[model samples]
Target: MVSLLKNRVNIASGTPSRIKKLIDIEALVLSRLAVILLDIHPDVKGYSLFTLPQVRDEFWDLYKNYFHQRLLEGDLRICLYGPLPSGNEFKGKKST
Candidate 1:
């Protein structure tokens, strides 16, 4: 996913895709953690992500560090929403 972020730092250079990953990508670190701990992507309970009583409690710090690093290095964009307003025209999977 780091590669995805690297390739999308610029909004003007991108094309529309099947996945709408802007807002949800904000909490991407949690999804990474969830995948590590539960083999899932949902947070389960991200309310206290910073003060978790579990082994993955450090994940929040890691996420924050990576985010800041990306910002400082200009590897990610502050305007992650890009040229669109976002989520208003979502093309999510059909309800089955």
Candidate 2:
């Protein structure tokens, strides 16, 4: 997760509206990238990401500071799924 607003602030270069637009752009690009990757590799059901504990904590802090309000009031939800531990193909997987 990129801290667009904080980074801008650190370098002294962001308005509230500008930061909002940058965050939105990043979210949109990441969403689209997921779709594109799925299309490119049908066997790739999804991705698993890991982070250092400190980084994970920082991410939550950033999320609380920036996105908590929008998440509570807006139509947004987090979805998680369990991919097969043995990879994408099951014993009797069907072919597309």
Which prediction has the highest lDDT against the true structure?
2
TM-score of each: 0.22, 0.31
By TM-score, the best candidate is: 2
**Clash tally, candidates in order:** 0, 0
RMSD to truth, every model = 16.0, 14.3
TM-score of candidate 2 against the unseen true structure: 0.31
Worst 10 residues of 1 by lDDT: 11-20
Q: Which parts of model 2 have CA positions greater than 4 angstroms off?
A: 1-51, 83-96
Residue 7 displacement (Å), model 2:
29
User: Which digits, one per residue and each the tens of the lDDT, describe model 1 over residues 27-91?
Assistant: 23322221111112224463222223342344444436444566455554433222332333223
Off by over 4 Å in 1: 1-46, 77-96
Candidate 1 lDDT (Cα, 0 to 1): 0.33
